[model samples]
Target: MFYHLLFPLSEHYALFNVFKYITFRSAYATVTALLISFIFGGWVIRKLEQMQIGETIDTDGPQHHQKKSGTPTMGGVLVLTAIVIPTLLWADLSNRMVLLALLGTVWMGVIGFIDDYLKVVKKRPKGMIGRFKLVGQVSYGLILGSILYFGGNGDFVAHTSVPFLKDVFINWGWFYIPLVILVVTGTSNAVNLADGLDGLAIGLSSLAFAGYAVIAYLTGHAVFADYLNLLNLPEAGELTVYCAAVVGAGIGFLWFNAHPARIFMGDTGSLALGGALGTVAILVKKEFLLVVIGGMFVAEALSVMAQVTWFKRTGGKRLFRMAPLHHHFELTGWSETQVVVRFWIIGVLLLLLGMSSIKLQ
Candidate 1:
């Protein structure tokens, strides 16, 4: 909004020209989102409290977490508000990539909101049948893939770059649609699985977005893209503002969501944030890079899968002390904070490794 209204006046006023810079707009977007989260954090928590929307803790989980059973959930509303408002205000509204990314975020957010509403308000333990949730994710992937395949007028390609290999690209052709479905659904569920600990999922997600923010900026810059042998995505630079907003929103939410949390983000935040990140990676043609950027989420999700597979194959024999990796650490005498901070450290290391791949080629 500011770009559309104020940037035009750069012709008459020199200061207005600053709005044309993605870096400047992205900086403001980050600050704006952080402010929005801080200002509205308490109010949103109060509303959730008033509505009696609280979390339900499982008896089998860590005993220390039982105390958080009633903390207000659905804090993702605050995160989405912070991210969307800033993106709309700071990004180029006409940009198709921005619009698609916003659509993915909001769509997954709505799915998560419904799940949270069912679990918290309606008292449904399972919350929005598993099939329905999968359907929603797959449906979103179909829409996004269709748009990317058909909307760009030959600008968009089904070829994705391979990290650490110069001039190496894989063309998925028509199979890219299924790949998109898998990426979107897998990432959304991965983050949801990792949200068991306070400040864990959001913290790692923020770092992932920070990495993508740099990738988006570089991909959109023709000189940098060419120099690095990356895909030159003309509209991707605007997504830097979106990524910054995600980072800012995550940090602001972490202020209240840290251990001894005042509120929980529930599925709303996890799904929306994960979907947004996946969409951004697809738009920037760095889909495979998400494995490295979101390494924690992938590990968490894989732990669950491994545990389940092992349990079934071995006639109920357990793999880890618990699934999701963090709980295993917790059961092994690591404090909750220890697990979270250590996971965050690993996430940062993976982020740096992923970024290095951008240049290693």
Candidate 2:
């Protein structure tokens, strides 16, 4: 869109030179998304409230959450809206990664929207069944994985670029297809589970964008890549712009999604964000490192599964007071805000650790 039409003219117009810098455009993108979310978030929340699209707290799960029953649902729309607009205006529309990212935003968004609609409109207690959601995620993984494998685009073994590896490049074997499917699907579900708290998921997800964006930039710049002994991916640099858009969008979404949440992102945001992260990782050729960068999400998701499995296996029904770890603190007398903020702090720490991997490796 504006990126292409205005970029060529950048050479002729001195002011347009700002468009050449991903950092500059990223700043604008971040501000644009933040403004959009801050301005429109209230209206969207009001509309949802009027429509009676509210949260349905699991009564058996947590007692205090019942008060959140009337909170507006489907807040993920705000994030998607803010992200798409600025990305279109500021990002290179010709980039394959950007196009795939846009497609991922729309595709997973619709899937989430359908689930939210079923719960909010149709009044289905279960909304979408677990199996159906899994199917959707798996289907997405299949599409993305196959595209990466057969599109002839991913044939470049130079794809696996781990920072500080000192010339050690790892390529995926033939089993990489199933491995990729597992990566994308698992990653999406991991983020989906982490989205249970206000600002928690989005905040942690932002850290990933920060890490991957730098990786994208390094990979794209031959000088940087060679100097650092990392893989030099020619077209992958555009991922920096995509990563910037994601960071901007997350901050914007967090504006209204803070503790006393004006709106809840629901599955719509979690799935879409997760899918977006996975797509960027694949494109940037750092699919494996995502495990370390997004470790918090994995830990949160695993907590739930571990608790459930333990409870079912033992008639004693023993586990954390609640799953997701955050709720466990809630049951232990921490306020919602307390749990949310502490989780955010933990996320910040983990983010630093993940970032350290770049230099430590």
How does candidate 1 fare on TM-score?
A: 0.98
lDDT tens digits by residue: candidate 2, 1-361: 6677877797789777777777777777777877888789889988998999998988777876788787898988888888889889888887766787787777787788889889888999788988988788778777777776777645563246564465556666555576666777777778887877778889888888888888888878899877766567777787777777778888877888887777899878888888888878877777767877887887887888899899989975968998887778888998877877777777777667766666555
Clashing pairs in 1: none
Given candidate 2, what's the lDDT at residue 6? 77
Candidate 1 lDDT over 32-106, as tens digits, reads: 999999999999999999988889998889898899999999999999999999999999999999999999999
Clashing pairs in 2: none
Each prediction's total of clashing residue pairs, residues at least 3 apart in sequence or on different chains, is 0, 0
**Model 1 Cα displacement at 314 (Å)?**
0.4
Q: 323, model 1: CA deviation in Å?
A: 0.8
Q: Give the TM-score of candidate 2.
A: 0.93
The residue ranges of model 1 lying beyond 4 angstroms of the native Cα positions read 153-156
Clashes (candidate 1): 0
